[model samples]
Target: MAECAFDFEVLALDGTPLPLSQWRGKVLLVVNVASKCGFTPQYAGLEALWRAYGPRGLVVLGFPCDQFGHQEPGDADEIRTFCTLHYDVTFPLAAKVEVNGKGAHPLWIWLKRQKGGVLGIDAIKWNFTKFLIGRDGQVLQRHAPTDRPESLARDIEAALA
Candidate 1:
């Protein structure tokens, strides 16, 4: 089993392999995203965070997930187009993934094991669940789906510092 965030591998929206090790020495906000969720608007704030802190060693990674209410039923191409046209999201986006159950992505499994959910539950309750990983590849915190991206600025700043 992987001991840290950098030990995992994910797929990009284009179906390219993306190793978390490539983001060594940078703070990462890993999110399970969905295009049709009510929290979908959070993409703007996520993009803002990316643009605001990117030069300072912060990277926001979005992983489109379909496990929550089938909210992200779109395929890779459709997801890419929706994000670009609606949110103008510029941060890196991963291919559609399952964030819960046995089919969950490895990175997510590690994240849940590391931080768990509110009250120590391991299951992700909904889309937009966020995991904040430090530059050292350790998970710093897990934010609830209702937590706005902007609300995470303080912790992100601290992690970057």
Candidate 2:
């Protein structure tokens, strides 16, 4: 396994290479998101967390994934538009990625290994699964799809401190 979260590189929604190394010292909330999922409204709380704690070094990265039920079937542009128009999300969003199975993104593979979900399962169960990374680039926690972003405030604040 990689030493830290910074050991991987992913692509931005615009197709630009985004190395997690750039966010080395920042607390990161990495989430696998989908526009059409039942948990889609969590975007608002995520954006709220970003806006509220961004200046203090919190970076919420949304990774659009279509692996679950084809909930996020849109292209990068459509995903971006939906997030902006519906949730007014301003945080950085990566291009579509596979969070499970053979085609999973490398970063996600690392994350799952770092902090497995319920019953120690490495596979991501659904859309909106969240991974919180500490400022030191270590995986801190794994949140299930049902866990709301707002519910994570205390943990986020602790990580920032």
Candidate 3:
């Protein structure tokens, strides 16, 4: 695995290669998202956070995943349309990715290793799992799916500081 979060690359919603290094020195709020899950509404809150902190070197990245209940089984275009119509998301979004098992994305695997789940499990438990990344690309904190995006302002502020 790569040494830091910046050492990974994930496909953008447009299917272009997007490298994490491009956001180096910026605080990142990385989330595994879904289109149809109960926590899908968090997208709005995430967008709010992005708008609130983006000017201060904060980038909110959403990665669509279908591992949980097939919630995000849409292609890039479908996902894009859904997000636009439903949440009006403007933050960056990675293409669909697997967040568990052998098919898990490299960045995800590294993230889990940096901060495990409840009971010390590395495997993701559900969608909307959040990771706060420092400006140096180190994993700073892991938040559960139930953690609202609005609740992270202080954490983001601290990271930005």
Candidate 4:
């Protein structure tokens, strides 16, 4: 049986396994992101958060998902280039993965179980859905697709403390 967020490994954009264990004991902002979604602009805010809090033990992990509206249609390289050129995003990004359904990533499945969405819907509602994971590798909070990255600072601060 799985234990915590560290139990899973997601593929990096380069297709190598990236283990969550590597970031154990750090506050994590895990976001299911998309390139063409209306919230795509949030990438700038996310990068800002990473730049501001990364030095203080915060890690922002972006998981590209194309499930909703086929928003993230690019391959890994395309996604990488877009993020770098547009948002100047410096955070680590995972390869595209489904955020819902049977093919949903294990980490996401476990996360929904930990903190159900609004109205108790565990499945992701749309792109840009975010989850905050504490240093202990457990889900700290589940954020709506509409929630801005900057709005999460207070909760992240409490978790870091």
Candidate 5:
């Protein structure tokens, strides 16, 4: 078994304790999301992936972030409202956080350590970056901001299988 890639807690937009451990035994797609980024529309694709694979053990977790280009300037409430009103998103969204920098969220720090992106760099370059995690809680893959959620169906299916 691979080593656990994450051990941290974050807040839900509603202030609930968002526990990474709750997702054990499920395939998780952890995304750093921004409301105003160019890739914002990816929310629709993510929702589609969730609706299609959720029952089969796929969980898409959105972590609202403003670390890139100030694209997500909203607070937790505003972020939640935008996601629900604009995309009808039913997936999990963590409270607004910094995904890079010295104060980056611990969960993100742990995630980057497990699956550094191209060239083995751990820093996130933009919003909508995706991290695929296996049922064993290990990070399996890292997809760039431009990679559509639908493109990940094959990997998700393989993990679930």
Candidate 6:
């Protein structure tokens, strides 16, 4: 059983809107990130995964969010430069968005509906929240902030297979 019915709009770092449907037929790892958060280092692991499996249809789409402690206070340009210089991130990054609370982005609303976290809570507690989507555009898993990107490699491999 998987959550496959949701569709969302993709926005560039500059807020240029795009269609998620264009990424169909590929495996996706969607993550909510914050530049100043302790888990920011996860960006390195995510980039590694993207470089390793990208040719095999895996893409790690990063969505920077400032909803957590204002950790991501930079504008789009700053955020883009930081990701490139500090993490060498090559995967697509969406514009800064609110991933939790009443003003949360619509894409996140659908994500929470598909899989609630510990104790059935629908809120995203912090940065580094990850959702894995299979080639069929189905939600395969919802990983908590504590789940390491390296640990998700097996699942990504399975999805590719």
TM-score of each: 0.98, 0.98, 0.98, 0.98, 0.95, 0.94
Clashing residue pairs found in predicted model 5: none
Error of 4 at 119 (Å): 1.3
lDDT of 6 by residue, 1-161 (tens): 22462267868887888567778889989999989999999999999999999999998999999988999999999999999999998899998888878888888888888888889888999999999988888788999888989999999999999
lDDT values for all models: 0.94, 0.95, 0.95, 0.92, 0.89, 0.88
Off-target runs (Cα >4 Å) in candidate 3 are: none
Q: Model 4 segments beyond 4 Å from truth?
A: none
Worst 10 residues of 2 by lDDT: 113-122
Tell me the tens digit of each residue's lDDT in model 5 across 65-87: 88888899998889988999999
Question: Can you write out model 1's per-residue Cα lDDT over 8-93, one digit (the tens) per residue?
Answer: 88989999999989999999999999999999999999999999999999999999998888899999899999999999999999
**Tens digits of lDDT, candidate 4, 110-140:** 9999999878789999998899999999998
Q: Which pairs clash (backbone N, Cα, C closer than 3 Å) in model 4?
A: none
Stretch of 10 with least lDDT, candidate 4 = 1-10
Clashing pairs in 3: none
Error of model 4, residue 24, in angstroms: 0.7
Point out where model 6 deviates above 4 Å. 1-6
Identify the runs in model 5 with alpha carbons over 4 angstroms from their true place. Answer: 1-6
- Candidate with more favorable, higher lDDT: 2 or 6: 2
